[model samples]
Target: MSSKCIVYGYMFLNVKMSSLLKRALFNNSQSIRKTAALFCNATRNHWNYQYQPGPYPKTPEERAAAAKKYGMTVEEYTPYPEDMGYGDYPKLPDIGEDSKDPHYPYDNPELKRNFNEPLHATAEIFGGDRCDISIRRRFSLLHQWTWFLGTLGGFALLMVFLEDYKIGRPVTAKQIPGQGVHYLFSPN
Candidate 1:
């Protein structure tokens, strides 16, 4: 073979080997399966733990006593961090005077007229349009798993093409040792 063919052969082999190595590293199915199995086993073992509901306060009196002991009552509460006695932090000014807010709902004349309004009306104000429109939709874990598998398949196909390009289709037996072998030593 000429020097050109030799260099071409070397380059072809190098590309084939490099691509094959890359594909093997990225798409090693056996290693992927082992890792996946280990993760699944760990997760299963963790979740297999026994779950027991905590004991409830047997009676209303016990519940009240527990609540009182824990300082859950409004009277026992302290002001928030900002409201506590002065610290290095600057004090926040009241919005009543500085804000352009007309105190739309609170300043309404109907509020004074309805000092006798039901508790549900006050609850409506707090719960108004603040409803959480931000909902989370759950997706199947299989979707991600299948995506990973597809990515590996794509890489493997690319490697197959690279190998085919580098090493031409398999040589026939006649082209190898069949035709040339007998002529070499015939010495006719």
Candidate 2:
């Protein structure tokens, strides 16, 4: 046979073998089999099969008849009441500024003293004690150094393990017998 004919023959065999393998693997897969079975069961008694197509029913009598023929019940449609014009609503009464009683139970007595005070004003202005606030050192230098060293050591150990672990080189179809023309399409 010519080289071109031999190449074509090998390509055809490779395609046929790949198709067979795919079919075998698909049939053997549990997820694929379950999914196909679920799809079949869901479509077995579909609405299109249960109901026949007919002209649209305009009147209530025709709709009722269609519903009965299709083994379904029909209910009369009712619309909600139309909203009244916006002007019809009653005007709200104005609250007097002199009202002494609190509008809500959770109102704080301190808030009533200065309702216009800016939020960033000193706490002492709100009757709080004038205490000096300073930042204290939470962690020592040695503790920080130990934490950094531990993280560095862990990363170094990980690098050492990764360096020692050797990955096998990928094998091409040409390296294996009877696997001609396969690696061109799939190297794995």
Candidate 3:
């Protein structure tokens, strides 16, 4: 085959391989992957897991064993709370922090944080403050009516303007002297 044809064939094979790789990576069906998994744990975060939930073994007999199995103990492990929904779970601790958020440098005040300075750092400062629009509406009653009437009036005027022009065959006909008289409409 020509050099061009050989290059085209290679390109086609590469495309096919890439597509197959993509299908294997991002396929909707997870049964094959789940079955293929040798072991499922919180660390791997597979769809099917058979992990022992906690009150974390933060200080296990072998801390390394806990670290290897659970990953950072309370620091990073996301317990399988699926059993909690079914009311068959252990008394899990108040779990919230995932350690993913950037640590605030308390020591260095000069360095501005890359994150936006939150409106309320510790608590919802504006939680108690409420504005009830029903009691006192933002727009006055007069203003509301004026706005509604203006839009409606403008629409009505445009409709009347459309009615001003009449487009159809003329009701009366002009006569050609040589030809017979013509009527645009037959007598009723």
Candidate 4:
């Protein structure tokens, strides 16, 4: 080809062949799978779009619409991170009284305030919020220390147990440290 097209300022290809490479690869205007819209959909404020909330509610009507959409009163409604850009906010479904609904274990203000108690059975293994609670009873600083030190100590203990063998060693047991000579003051 004579010229190369750079789509969305990312694709800078030196095209020399004539194939589907001409119509498909250069721009998001034509292709079905690799579209330019997906790559160009960067949020104004956040890097990761899936993890962040919408950038709506710039006005009172927007807030009322959002509150109504979530089936909550305007006073009771809480927006996540409040106004960044237009996001398809997840609809808040009613989880009922027992808190067994599928939506209950997801991130929400109520779950943050309420889920202080340890999760059990299915709840412990299933949801991100449930496992993330990680109360002091189930997880602790001591646990973290034990996890780290246990691995190091266990490896060291294995090495200490194995280093005494004469299979591949050049020294005798009497020449080994602590076997015959004292470490504090040992004269050869």
Candidate 5:
């Protein structure tokens, strides 16, 4: 009897543990699979593109010829300066020069603005209606034509409805025109 009870308890525990494991897997299956695939693709790209460097040039002459082909001079072969062309501008004065130099006027705020004032900002600020004569004339003609066509259409519809018979009114059993075939052929 004791052996029988032990076997039954073992079976019960096994069933309960398996059901809990299955429920957890059902909830997290998609996320686990997606993370695995992303890791594999990232590993593949790293191995394919970034790991390998090309064969090296074996001789000094070959290296120098390749450098000159790409416009690097012999002086630039070593560790290059970060500010290679920082002071190439013609207008910038030498760093240790005196402020009395003529080119130093560009560095002064009042002198720079007075010498090179922008054109548009100095003119009067006009509101939205301000425009050239040609634009105003074109828009005036366009507005007149649009108003005339809209009024003509409204008058034509009013005259049609004023007729003794409502030609274009929605049809009802009493208001429908007499039954007659208008045409038997296609409209075109």
Candidate 6:
């Protein structure tokens, strides 16, 4: 009789737990669907390119209408230069010989001498023997060691505060009920 009663009690608890779990799952699924719909709508509305018609205007009136709609003044459209096809290639500026530097004379004897010398020898003309300078450390070794120790101590303290020690283990009298020293080393 006691065994039958125990079985019936377990069956009732199972049905109740299953109903609660089903309700929770159904509510979570509905909330997720709502969140997804909101995100999709937000993404669609955020970018102007998603709603824009086309790259170029279909007709001459369409271009004028767009400019007028935006409250911008319309400039007269001029045909591209005859030499340039579709205006893809830009016209190169005509750089004349007069644009050369007057300080660095092309015909000067000193300029010719320096030009013929090896690249390594040219570095002597400047103050340094090497072209590139060595990088100096900003902080001293003592400062770096202090920073490392400080960061290590901070992380250790944070770990001690954040984690719960008595999650899976049985409670102890010396553990002070709620507060206990959670050591990093676990026996198991």
Candidate RMSDs in Å, in order, are 32.1, 34.9, 16.1, 16.9, 26.5, 31.2
lDDT tens digits by residue: candidate 4, 108-128: 544332432322223434354
Count of backbone clashes for each model?
A: 0, 0, 0, 2, 0, 0
Residue 28 local lDDT, model 2: 82
What's the best-to-worst order under TM-score? 4, 1, 3, 2, 6, 5
TM-score on alpha carbons, each prediction = 0.22, 0.20, 0.21, 0.31, 0.17, 0.19
Report the error of model 4 at residue 150, Å. Answer: 2.8
**lDDT of candidate 2 over 129-165, digit per residue (tens):** 3322332347887999999999999999999989978
Off by over 4 Å in 2: 1-134, 167-175, 178-188
Higher-scoring candidate on lDDT, 4 or 6: 4
- The models' CA-based lDDT, in order, is 0.47, 0.52, 0.49, 0.52, 0.47, 0.51
Off by over 4 Å in 3: 1-40, 46-149, 161-175, 179-188
* lDDT score for candidate 1 against the true structure: 0.47
**Which tens-of-lDDT digit does each residue in 1-188 have in candidate 3?**
79999999999999999998788777855854775674653566646444432343334444445444433443443333443442212232332122113365633333322342221221232222332222445789999999999999999998999897878987777556667655368586
Model 3 clash tally, residue pairs: 0
Q: Residue by residue across 65-126, what tens digits does model 6's lDDT show? A: 64454333346332224444422112222222233244665454333323322222223443
Which ten residues in a row are the worst by lDDT in model 4?
A: 113-122
Better of 2 and 4 by TM-score: 4
Q: So what's the TM-score on candidate 6? A: 0.19
In candidate 4, how many Å is residue 111 off?
A: 16
Model 2, C-alpha of 97: deviation from truth (Å)? 39
* Per-residue lDDT over 1-188 for candidate 1, one digit per residue giving the tens place of the 0 to 100 score: 89999999999999999998778768886875786798877566545221221233445664455334333443332222433432212222221221223354553343322342222212333332433222232655688788999999999999987885675687656444454445445557
